[model samples]
Target: MRQYIVLSDAPWRSVPSRTQQLSARFRGEVLYFEPPGASKRSHRDPGRQVRPNVILYTLPSAGLLPVGGGLARPGGWRRQGAFISRAVLRHGFREPLLWTTCPAQVHLLDHLTYRGLVYDCAADWSRLSPRWEGDLAAAADVVFAASPALADHLSPCSGNIALLPNGVNFPMFCRSDLDPPRELRGIRGPVLGWIGSIDERLDLSPLLRTAREHPRWTFLLVGKVLRNPLLAALQALPNVHFAGRRPMVEIPEYVGCFDVCLDLRRKGQDIYEIVPRRVFEYLSTGKPIVTPLYPGQVEAFPDVIYGAHGPEEYSLLCERALEEDPAWVSQRRKDYGAAAAWSRRVEEVQQILGDIGLA
Candidate 1:
């Protein structure tokens, strides 16, 4: 059977990242490795079987060293690399596809061998470790970029980079049968929902002003709110609801409660470069989406998604999304979402591999 060794950035238990989703769909025996644990000691467990063909393993502790650039301490990674090598041999994995998400973990290449290397660039890691990321991309047989911006950024390192944007599990989000989560029951007005990590990347000003302007319209945000001063003011609003992180399975249910979905981005940032994962999920539900006038969104799904300029435009777009969406438009959104499903994304990757003679 074909085999894969995936070096994941996120743990298997966390809300499914791209690595987890793609690995689950790969038709082979997958030996998935999570990032090193906090403890200094190595793990005793062999591995955990998350799926019938996917076995999850956590790398032994790599110490509290800064894991960036080529100058990082080798002692920790050497040990971690040794552990991974042993796992590979124990599982009898021969010439497995090496799929790496983290640039810091590239040191494992020193101790492991693989048929082909696939660098999955989900974000721009240039600031984190330009040297390490550059070397990885340059050495990769194929590079998969999550956005057009990322593809452009990595073009200098590799000539074989492919644009593999974030995708939604279409069937899960497209289900119209889900009942709204209980947390949304008390919301009084049209729900303007947003999901994913609530962090500094968010432009809370639009949400704040919009929430205040429409006191009855609930701005429902469902995710972990990181440290941001603007959140305090948003929390003060009566209509702004912050539902903390829920299980991945429950996201569709929460999204079902939303009348209009939001894709808010911080101002002064390269908003055009970003392709939020939640946008695809929103599209899958056929919900009207209001986001910044990102060229990527406008160009890709011009008819399906609405783009706005400033706070006033943002609010107006939300209102228009709620008021203007027709039944046929909703179906078109669903079709767009289905076209970008993870299954189809994987097929695209397979085709790229075949063209490059790696498959």
Candidate 2:
């Protein structure tokens, strides 16, 4: 058996389900080391053991701090390096692959030596801090950018950059188009739905204004409220219905209830170019999408109805979607769905690992 260790901030639930699925395919056991409860702070921490054929480090988000946060600490990268160094000292595995979404980890590369490093640029992290991102790009051995535009941005730093856009779990989102569950059945006519955490990244103002403008159209907002102010303001909108967070198994049923879907991401300094995972999930549902226009979005999903960055365009797009034929949009979604499966994306990652002799 080809053994491997997945070093990440624990409570494994925080890690993306796609990453979990990919790890399982490698015929390896995953050991999640929770950051808050990690054995030690520095790389020399004891009680840490590294006995595996391969050690894969999954980096954490740079901006979000740990629970009870005081200045965000380095848990993912630092702990990973500690384990890798220990493995080198004990078993002599000289090179390990550092797979990370955070661009800041690039600076720490000088502190440790590995055979090669793979930067999974899941989002346009450079937007957060351009200078820091440049430093990170210079350090990565291979850059797997989530989109072609992201790859282009990192091209100046690494020649090995590859475009590996986000993929969907077909089975999870693409359920039988049966009626929605009883809880969602009461959501009134011309239902336009949006599902995701109520976070700073969500641009709910446009959705709120749009819902108010068209009183007949009910807007269903799903997912938990991470930020209270945003949730409270959205709840005040008379046409908007807050479904709150439901179980993952029930998401599709909620999505199916929508006559049209919404993927309204706030055009922030961090997320303007990055595509949200929910956009793909909404696409998988074969519902017409009313999304904000951003750089590279036109190329990413040419089929989506691009709304201008304000309430006017958003309201117009929603009205257009409501009037449009569902069958035509549904067909386009099915076409796009086949190409954006998680299985395909994982295979690409495996190929990259094999090329670098990490697989």
Candidate 3:
């Protein structure tokens, strides 16, 4: 069987990531490695078989050591690298394909041999060191970018970059028979919801203003809320509800309760480049989605989503989205979701790999 060794930046959890989804879909056994920062306590565990053919191993976090060029101190890298090598041999992973999301994880090249290396660039990591990202991109046999902007950003680094935007499990989010989560049952009015990490990257101004303007309409924010200054003001609004974070599987139940799905992200060139994976999930539900008119979003979405700018336009678009969603429109959106499903994305990756003779 084909084998893959994935060095992921995020932990393998109930909330699936691109790395986890793609790896699980590969027609082979996968030895997935979660970096040390994900969890320190799980470092000593042998391995967790998260899927039938995917085993997860967590590396020890070098909390006390200085990390440079993505490697911990000499002892730290040596021990972790040795551990990975042992695991590779135990799994009989000979010349396995290597994949990494983090640029810093490139240091693992010193300890492992792979038939080919794939770099999946899902986020902006140039802040760590552009040189590191450049080096990793240069070494990668292929690079998959999550957005058009990201592809453009990384084009200078690699000639073989391809667009593999974030996607959703279409069947999961499109279930219409799901019962609404208990959190929404008590609420009476129409719910305008935003699901994902509620962090500083979120532009709460438009949402805050809209919430204040329409007290009768419930504004549902379902996700982990980070330290944002406007959160208190939002919490103070009686109509606003924070359902906290829910498992990826349960998100559709929450979406079922939403009258209109809202995408509120902070305005910036950087933020514009990010195509939130939740957007695809939202589309899967065939729900009326109202989002900002970010760069390339209108072209990317075209007929599928409603775009607005600022509070005035955002408020108006929400009204339009609620009123304009007909059966045909909803079906069209669902079609978009079907085309952008994780399964299709995995297939696209495989096709590209085959073309490059890496498969």
Q: What are the per-residue Cα lDDT tens digits for candidate 3 across 178-288? A: 998865788887899999777776788888888888889999989998978788899999999899998877889999899899987764535426678888999998989
Each model's lDDT comes to 0.82, 0.63, 0.83
Q: What is the lDDT of residue 124 in candidate 3?
A: 72
Output candidate 3 Cα RMSD. Answer: 2.4
RMSD per candidate (Å) reads: 2.4, 5.6, 2.4
TM-score of 2: 0.76
Model 1 scores a TM of 0.92
- Which 10-residue window of candidate 1 scores lowest in summed lDDT? 63-72
Best by lDDT: 3
- Between prediction 2 and prediction 3, the one with superior TM-score is 3
1 versus 3: better lDDT goes to: 3
Q: What is the TM-score of each candidate against the true structure?
A: 0.92, 0.76, 0.92
Q: After superposition, how far is residue 24 of candidate 1 from its true place, in Å?
A: 0.7
